[model samples]
Target chain A: MRHRARRKVNQFILHCILLLGGALMVAPFVWMVLSSFKPSLEVISINFSFFPRRWTLANYIRVFREVSLGRAYINSLLVASCVTLSVLFSATAAGYLFSKLRFRGRDQLFILTLASVMIPPHIVLVPLYTLMNRLQWINTYQGLMFPFLMSAFGIFLMRQFIRGIPNDLVEAARIDGASDFRIYWSVILPLVRSALAVLGILTFLWNYDEFLWPLVVVHDNRMMTIPLILGHFTQAEAKFPGESMAACTLVVVPVLVVYAFFQTQFVKGISMTGLKG
Target chain B: MVAKRRVFNTYIILVASIVFIYYVLVCVWPFAFNLYLSFRKTDLLTEDKFIGLGNFRFLWKDPIFWRSLRNNIFYLAMMVPLGIVTSLFAAALIYRTSGIMRKVYTALYFAPVVTSMAAASLIWQLLYYPKIGLFARILSSLFRLDPNSLTFLQNPTTALLCIIIMDVWKDSGLRTVIFLAGMDEIPDSIFESARIEGASEWRQFFSLTVPLLRPQLIFVGAIYSINAIRLFVPVYMMTGNPPGGPANSTKVLAIQMYQEAFYGLRFGYGATISMVIFALLVGLVILELRSFEQRWEY
Candidate 1:
């Protein structure tokens, strides 16, 4: 009975600590949401209150009116979707070839791909910008979407997943005279559905959150993505904290909703991505 | 049979060629071009003149370059250990709990990671607003510090630290989850045996858990260090009037590179700075790998 009581006390202490930590983790987001609802004057005022004195939609209305936020949203969706689909197609094809096909210089090429992962985007920023300029692709979707069409990380991930698939299955398909493309499409693709989903979601998220490339490549307000618009909103129009918070809320809500629905898959994908130790 | 073999070979060659061409154009060519530009005096539109080591000499003489490098080191020093320890502690606590509570806590912590950095930085800037900000209000109430006087981002002494603290808060959730996953991988039998031997929770943690968590710790350290070295968005967004300002206190290498290349239109100088960043990251990665090797067998 005494031991049971000790365990209960320990659990209570753990609960208190975790609850506090959880609150700390979530408070900024809550504050962001609440401050968005507060009147503009109240948001920047000295009076501290968790609850808004008089809630308003003025900020949201102002955000839509003043900024190209709607266009930015559409741009973000288009870029993310295109990049995700392109990465999936390229990564899976390359991954299947690397994992299943026997070819000359395959290992060396794979190593080269892996080495490219270590090259930070900043390192190549100047040349890439110049290349985009030369191609007349600046301020264009093609420039924004081209560099990220496939990533070393995506190829590595797909390769790892594809390698895990049984050789017997591929052999059986081959015995029936299935073409390489047919085998890849019908047999291999379905088997790696979970990996595809994870890669697709991750690719989309990364592209959506991308800032620097978009900031550099797209000078046109109409071509700006969500992060770029948020940067502009904060830097240029941060005087109105309420409207800025509302803009933030808009920028964050879609990702948050996606995360909510796919929390488990998201967590699993993050862990499996080798990003975590 | 010949036709079939030809088709198979064609498919392989076609797919392989696509991957090769894409990577060469996007990755390989840009890297080579950056290297070449680093050695030349050019601003993309100007006549390219080969002036080997000139850019490096310029970088060597630039005090701002050194300051940015120092600031990056400071960020790395503060963020890595603090992030790891706090997240590890949180992970341990969460690992002890089970059911819906764990999921709720995990989701709450991870919310910030999913939020775009621009949005996160903007929200944090509001929080750190001197007079009316939440932080100022809390600190003033707790320690009687003048809330109106505490300009966290404006004051050079506190600016970088404020950003570090925000980064820690934003990142600890992901770190916590990673640590929890690592902890979960440890066999329960060892813990049960340790408990049966009358070992306290702390003893089991130190003796069994910490050693086992070395890989995770090293990995988290390396990643966070890489992130710290390349820190940009917060500095860009949070420093208000001038992006990396209040006398350039928050200036980092990545931000410096951006300013030099895009804003200053000195592509060669920017490429040199990027090379410096690359060298620094490679050195850190090597150090992390060495430590990882020395500590763990598997």
Candidate 2:
């Protein structure tokens, strides 16, 4: 009975500590959402209040009115979706070929592909911009979407997941006169659905939050993605903290929604990436 | 059968070729061009001239370049270890718990990781607002500091540190989840035996948990360091009027590279800075791989 009480005390202490940490972790976001609803004068006022005295939709309304946020949302959605789909198809195909097919120089090719992961995007920024310029793709969706169509990490991830699939399944399909392409589409792709989903989520989030490339390539306001638009909003109109918070909330809402619905998959995906290292 | 095999090989080749072409155009070609441009005197507008190491020489003496490098190193030193320690603590606490509580805590922590850096920076900027900010109000009232005098982002001495704090806050959730996953992989029997042998929780944690969690630690450490070295968004978003202001105190290598290339129109010089970043990251990655390889052999 004494030992049970001691354990309970310990657990209580742990909970206290964790809850404090959790509050610290969550405070900024709560503050963001709350501040978004606060009137503009109150947002930047010296006297900090946790909750707004008077709530208003003025900030959000201003966000929509002053900026091309609606267009930017559509732009972000289009780019993220296209990039995700392209990555899935290319990664799955390449993953299938690397894991199941035999060919000359295949190992070398796979190593080359894997090594590209080390080449950070900044290294290629200048030349890629120049290339985009030369190709007349600057300020175009193609420029924003082209370079990230497939990623080395995606290919490697798909390959790792695909290799786990039983060889007999592919063999059985082959024996049934299903061509390699058909086997890939009909057999391999479905079996690695979880990995595909993981890759899809990761790819979409990455493309959606991408800032530097779009900042450089797409100078036109209409072509701006969410991150770029938010960046501009913060940089240009930082005086209006309420509206900036509203814009920030708008930018974060979609990702938070996805995260809420797919928390397990999200955690699993992170673990898989971490464990791969 | 021979014809069928040939057709299959062709299909594979075709698919592989498409990926290869994309990689080459996007990755290889750009990289090769970056390397070439790093040695040339051209802004993509003028006729190209061979400047052979001129850009490097300029960067060698540039005070801002040195300052940016120092800031990046400072950020890495502060962020990497602090991030790992805080996340490890959070993970250790959460790892002992289960059920809905675990889910709630994990999600709460991870909320920031999913938020875009732009949004995270904006939110943090408001939090660090001088007199009106929540933190300023709390700090001043609790510690009896003057709230009206406090300026977090505008003050050069505290600006980078403020950014680092926000970064650690933003990133620790993901690190915590990763650490929790690592902790979960440790077999329960090991802990049971440690307890049977009369080891305290602290003793078990240090002796068993720490050593076993080395790979995850290394991973989190390396990734955090890499991210810190490439720090851009927060500094870009949160800093003063010109960004990286209060006298260029918050300027990092990645930001400097961007400014020099795009805004300054010094493509060759920017490429040179990028190569420096590239070299540093590759060195870190290689070291990480080597350590991991050694562990695998053991």
Candidate 3:
């Protein structure tokens, strides 16, 4: 009985430690949200407040009113959605082949795909820009979305997931006289829905936050993504820190909402990707 | 089985072609062009000149290139191990805890990962303010430190270090989750046996966990190294895009490449620098992956 009580006390201490750590980890974000609401002068004031003195929606209103934030938001949403859909389409089709098919040179081709991941995007940045320019894609949606539409990581992830499915199920589908594409769409796709979800969310998040490629490829402000737009304001470093803060908040909020909704799966996928790599 | 094999062969070939073309265009073709570009001299308005590796010769002699390369190494040195240690510590603590607390802690650690790079960069910009930001105010209050006069970003000596510090904080959480997942996978039976043998927690951790988690450690290390080397956003934000502030103290290789490609409009020279970065990353990745494969005995 005494030992049980001791164990309970130990568990309580551990829980308390975890809760405190969690709060400390989350404090910056909490601070960001609070600071966004605080008046601009109060934001940089040495006398910081955990809670704001005067809570207002002024910053957000300013974001929409002052900057071209709405257009950037729409651009980010459109590009991210397109990238996610296309990555899914390509990766799923390839994954199905790699796992279920036995074509010649499949292993050689898969190795080739894997090799590309090691070549950092920066290495290809210049050449890709040149290519995009030649295609008259510079400062266009196609320039922003085309190269990223097929991701090595997404393909790798889907391949791993598909590899785990039983061979018998695929054989059963074939025995039923289903066409290969039909089996892929109706059968394989449903089987790997979880992987697709993981890939989609991950791709969406990455494309939404992508800055460098877009910065290089798209010079047109009218076509700017949120990160690129927010980047311009921050880079300008004008006296109006309020509007920049507003823009930053505008860029952050939607992703946070998506994260909140799909926190578990997204995190699981991210964590898994890290371990796998 | 024969029919299935025939069907599989056709499908695999079809898939292979698409993936092959993608790899060729996105990965191989551009890389070849990057190499080709590096050897030539080209401005945006002029025709590219084939100088047979003139850019390499110039880069080898360029003072700024060498300085930026050194600064990049310094940044990586500070960022990588600090990030690894902090993350491992956080992961260990979380692993020691239970249920609801675990979920809460995980999400908190992951918040920065979910946040956009631009947004995080801006937040850190404010946080590093010499007079009004949290770091400065704390220093001033506690030790009478003259934090009000110092602007880390504007000062060349402090700019790179400041960015390194922020990168560690933002990136450590993701590393922690990766380490935590690896730690969770270690069989409890092994630890239990160690405990039964009268091993202390520290001894058990150092003796068993560290060695057993080699593959995970290598994976995290390699990925972080690659990502850290590609550091662009914070530098772009903090140092006003040219990076290397206060007479070019913080200018890393990637920033230099960006300047060459986009700002200077020396497309060929920019491509050359990009290729150098590519070669370095590829070498490191190959070494790490080989070791990871060898260590992954399970």
Candidate 4:
């Protein structure tokens, strides 16, 4: 009984500590969200408060007016969607083929793709930009989506997931006179739906949060993505903490909401890929 | 299977050809171009002139380049281990929670991970503002210092450390999840046995849980280190008007590369930095994997 009480106390202390740390982890964004509603004067005042002194949408109004975050949101959405769709298509086909179809040098090709994942995006930034310029893709949506069209990790992930299906399933499908693409589309796709979701979310988030490449490629405000515009404000509008926090709120709140909605999937997929986030 | 091999053969060829073409265009071609550009002197204006080892020699002696490289190594050293320790603590504590408390704690911790670094940096910059900043005010009162003079991102000494702190805060959630997943994979019976044997919880965690989580520790360490080397967005967003400021205190390889190629229009020099980063990335990954194989055999 004494020992059980001691363990309980220990567990209680641990919980208290974790709760404090968790609060610290979340406080900045919460503060940012709140401060977004502050007028410029209170935002720059000598005292800090979680609650704005006076409720106002002027900060958000400024961000919307000056930055055109609406266009950036659509741009981010379009780029993320296109990249995610392409990665899924390319990874799905490559994965299915590498796992199920026996071709000459198939293992070698898959290994080559696998090896590319080791190269982080930083290494290719300089050359990829020049290549985009050469192809006249700069400031175009194609520029934003081109390099990410096929994900090496996505291919590896899909192959790993697809390889788990029983060979007899594929053989059965083939015996039923299913076309190669048909088996891939109907039989294989449904089975790996969860992997697709995970990969799609992971890819979408990574591409969605991309800052450097877009900062390099997109010169037009119309071409600005969420991160790009947030970066723009940071560089250009550093004086206005109100507008900056409002921009931060606008960019981060939606992601946080989607993340809250898909909490388990987000954690599982992000922890699995250890991607962007 | 053999009878229908012809049909499979045709389909595979088509798909493989397309994938192979993409691989060449995106990965192999650009990678080769990066290497090729490193050897040439062309700033996108003049005609290309092969420089042989000129760029590498200049990079070897560039003080700013050396500073950036030193900063990167410093970042890798500080960020990864501190992050892992925090993660271990957070994850261990989290694993103790049950039911809805677990979900709430997890969500609370993970809110930062979902936020983009760009946005997070801006939020953190606000908190780090010398006067009237949330943390600055709180810390000033706690330390009996003036809020107006509290220099976090402004001071040369504290800039990189401040960035690392924010990063560790943002990234710990993801690392915590990874560690928690690893802990879940461990059998509860191990801890039970430790308890039955009169081992304390601390002893059990140290002896059993941590050792059992060796694979995850190494994995998270490597990932964090890789992420650390490519640290740009926060630094870029946080330090403006030359990107790496406060006397280049927080200048890192990625930022240096960006400034060189994009800002300075030194394409050759920038490619040289990329090559250096590529080398470091591959070398570090190889080193980590090798250590994983050889160092932790117990």
Where model 4 places Cα greater than 4 Å from the true spot, the runs are: A236-238, A272-277, B1-8, B292-298
Evaluate residue B103 in candidate 4 and report its C-alpha lDDT on the 0 to 100 scale: 91
Arranged by DockQ, best first: 4, 3, 2, 1
lDDT of candidate 1 over A1-277, digit per residue (tens) = 9999999999999999888888888888889999999988888776678889999999999999999999999999999999999899888988888998877777878887876766756568888888899999999999999889888888888888888888888888988999889988998899989988988987888899888888889999999999888887556544788999999999888789989999988887787674522
Every candidate's chain B TM-score: 0.93, 0.94, 0.92, 0.94
TM-score of each: 0.96, 0.97, 0.93, 0.96
lDDT, candidate 3, B178-222, per-residue tens: 888889999999999999999998898788888887877888878
* Model 4 lDDT tens row, B240-284: 778888899999999999999999898988989988888888887
Q: Return the clash pairs for model 4, or none.
A: none
TM-score, candidate 2, is 0.97
**Candidate numbers, best lDDT first, in rank order:** 2, 1, 4, 3
Please give the CA lDDT of all the candidate structures: 0.85, 0.86, 0.79, 0.85
lDDT score for residue A70 of model 4: 97
- Candidate 2 residue lDDT tens string, B107-193: 989989888988898888878888757788889889999887788888889889999999999988889988898899889999998
Q: What is the lDDT of residue B241 in candidate 2?
A: 53
Calculate DockQ per candidate and list them: 0.59, 0.62, 0.63, 0.65
